[model samples]
Target: MATQVTFSEVKNNGLGYWGVLGFFGLLVLGGVFAFLHMHEGHYTTGMNNQVVWGIPHVFAIFLIVAASGAANIATIGTVFGQDVYKPQGRLSLALAGSLLFGGLVVLLLDLGSLGHVIEMAKGALNFKSIFAWNMILYSGFLLIITLYNWTMMDRRKIAKKLYKPLGIVNMAWRFMLTMGTGSIFGFLVARQYYDAAILAPLFIVSSYVFGTAIYSLVLMASFKLTGRDLGDIVLNRLRNSMAVYLVLVLFFEMTRHLTNLYATEHHAVEAYILTGDSIFTSLFWYGQIILGSLVPMFLVWCRFFKNNRLAHVTAAVLAVIGGMIQIYVILIGGQSFPLILFPNAEVSSAFFDGVNNAYTATMSEYLLGIGGVGLAVALVIVGMKGLRLLPTSLADDVIDPLNLEKK
Candidate 1:
């Protein structure tokens, strides 16, 4: 008979844990300071009339989309009946909720005032706006995930019965949340870069890539720190899954760019992003394509690095960096591109019309974005500390009963 897998709270109250806590605490503080500073005046930051959504939005959107993606592990285990993934479902759900909260924090702060956020929360919503719809989606995601976690953690018989059903609901909700986020940009018909239906699916696939990368890294780090038995079977599965997501995201991205290039009206923006002498061009080709997608793919598939833990870690880290750069290119680059206010007509405006908008991220903006990440990590750590979110062992024999039979 296979040994039963047990779950436990993280008990490492050592120097390393405290040090990490302190570091993330500082990051959260920095984000608070940035919000206060920016709240003083929008002029304090790099945002202008042309480029409204700045670096914070990039981070916010990335985390929000990634939150949906991170839940994929739990979805696979419960919805698909994958036993190998079941062990990590608790951690997956916890991480998903934490990431969403962190991302929402940054988003609310960046909206410019506490009062505005309060009013929105108090039911002052414009139903016509996609943003309003997303507010509901985000709230529903948190509530559903919370309840799902309860079902997973509770010992009640009813909870066990509801687990798969809740997982299915959470999976559907996550898809809608991510699609809504992508639609925020896709619905912008005036923007040459974002006016594509492909964005919804593109973001969905991109979430898979980014979320899986982040989850792999966090899982590895947690198991390593806690001295848990994290077997190669789990790591290999995550690595292979990430590789597939990378290919899908790349395909979607290629389709998006190709569709843009095919349209004569979008040629200028395409040239600017793809071939122009700008940071976006470098980030797209070097950061997103080569280092982010291709290199990670090579690392995972190369026989030389097979079963190599360090290689997997490097690939996950690179994927994360590449994912962030990809979001930057999409969110910031899209806004920086000149708007087509007057097609085929000589138009001049004092508000820097007919030219690419200039934007340089301030230190405050970087802090706020980094803070959101720190908050997410911190929340996961705290959740693990208070709850039995991690399996005591994820050894091949433990997760896969077939391994025991073979042995």
Candidate 2:
């Protein structure tokens, strides 16, 4: 048997490390702006009745989607019987749990009341509400994944037997959680841009793409920073997987928009996203397509730089940047367009009813969104420092002996 890879805690012994932590701390301080919004009211933010969800939702939803995707790494090892991925199991689990927590923090802060959340926790919730269902799903996901991660680390025979079942359950639950999240927008009946069934599956595939990208970057950075060896075999496997996911995500996007464009009723929203000179158009074309998809794809698939480490980093960074732009377009751009309340007649009202309502994000919204990202990074840092999350090395000879065996 291959020598079982050992897990060790990251060394927390540098000014550079402290500086990174301080940077995340500054981001968390941005939450003071969130507190101001909460105390003063939603009026303080760009969100109004029309654009009910703003930049915060963009960040929160992305983090949540990425969280679900991050868990895929562990699932490949435990559920798929892929021993090549087994060494990555612990770090994957830690990142998944931490990302979810960060997202939930942003989401909860955005809610109307802290007391309402307390009440909901006390079982004063509407089970019929998708929001409530998500709360359950999110909470249950954390609990089950924590247990699952524990089982993976436990060597007791009882824990071993329980491990596979828990892994299967974790996978199923995460799918449900992400599907529920997509349904938040997918089920918006009043919104012309949102009422599509494809959003759920699209979100699922998107989670895979964005989540894998984040994981690959974190893995590389962690290894490099800690002076550990991470091999080309693993990097190639991960980047290739990300490339496949990117293609799938692009397919889903084409299906979504093409299906929408086929209907005359959907033409206006498509025009807003694809043809207009607005920020949404630029973000979709440049950020999502060019920088996010095409460029990263080239970096990974290019034969000349297949094994180059810098190529891997560039692809991962661009993939993450593109993922953010995609979410922003979906959340804010979808809301930015006028609602077609009267199909046959032009309408106007004080609430900007049936007209394109501009959502100009304020400093507070930007800070809060940045804070959400900061929260995720902070959680990752803390997990690495506090737990035995990082492995000593992932050199090809150490982790990829299975390939030799197969040959």
Candidate 3:
């Protein structure tokens, strides 16, 4: 830490005692919720047949995307030998490992049954279903990251040696993860998803943006809370990266929308989401556009503003805040409107018939998601405390942080 910190330096290492307290408190919320759901069944989760994959899906997807993106920061150094990016690399790596684990916890909990939790390992060999492979792929993804990032008392030096290989491998692994996730939506030939070929590329691109954004913001907060100076150079470069990502993410989203509009039947699900009723519009306009897009863009791209640190931090925060909403719109919003086009006329599945099928998340579902994040937070905080996640040899505002990977 840049500043002198003490044991009583505030709860959870300046994340605010309240933040940590609440975070832990949620475990209680989740536990109580889980108990209720397990006893009563999944009738409380806000899920319907049309919206089967709700917020938990969005949350789970967010972790995976963010997890992969976190590792990309490591590439800037290990693969490219650009150490100016190194200051943020450790945090990126740590969070990547933590988020992947957290996401798995959330996803498995959503399944509502732990029948195949271990069988998830056997899934990759199947190759019959892309989703099946994800069971194994993400597991390996987390493993490689953990092994590469974790500090082994005896193997610490040896582990660092793997950085270079891990860099390139990390890139490839992320490619697989994104492709696997996209395939979940893309390869639905039985439905309109057959035309979702473009979705995979967009998913990868979005991961880059959202992942970097979240890590950047979290690091900024870490610095400020820990009393470290980010220096102008580091902040400037990060802001530049955020600005670039924000613009690129916008391009990807816009392009996807246009493509969906131009093609026949492809527009069926997405169209309703982009230009639909209150639910979708509110999330897109208020959540995506406002929280995710325009605000961050203006802040990061402002020429007159020399406050790179603030710009960097704000942009990163907005990127995650907006990206979170964006992912929700894509994942949950994508599911909100089911696939139903009878031969006679256009149709939407806002509700189910015959009986009120219970699609809600129930208590257990939310608890699992909460617990996953809690696990991540606890792990991250402990990692930070143990390893001093802050730059140890780094000086604040140095002209260059020294490219560890390059030289």
- The most accurate candidate by TM-score is 1
Alpha-carbon runs more than 4 Å astray in model 3: 1-39, 119-125, 150-160, 190-195, 267-270, 341-371, 393-407
lDDT of 3 by residue, 1-407 (tens): 21221111112544474575467557646744664464444566676556667666777887787788777777675677665665556677788888787777677666755665566555435678787789778878877776655531124677767766766777788889987886787886544433467677767777777777767766666666666556655566566676676777777777777877786666656656666563666888887777777787788778766665666667678778787788776666555554554533654444452222333455456676666666666666666766645563334424253432211
Candidate 2: regions farther than 4 A off: 1-3, 402-407
Ranking by lDDT: 1, 2, 3
Report every candidate's CA lDDT: 0.90, 0.86, 0.65
TM-score of each: 0.97, 0.95, 0.82
- Preferred candidate (TM-score higher): 1 or 3: 1
Judged by lDDT relative to the true structure, which candidate is superior, 2 or 3? 2
Ranked candidates, highest TM-score first = 1, 2, 3
Which 10 residues in a row give candidate 2 its minimum summed lDDT?
Answer: 398-407
Q: Is candidate 1 or candidate 3 better by lDDT?
A: 1
Better of 1 and 2 by lDDT: 1
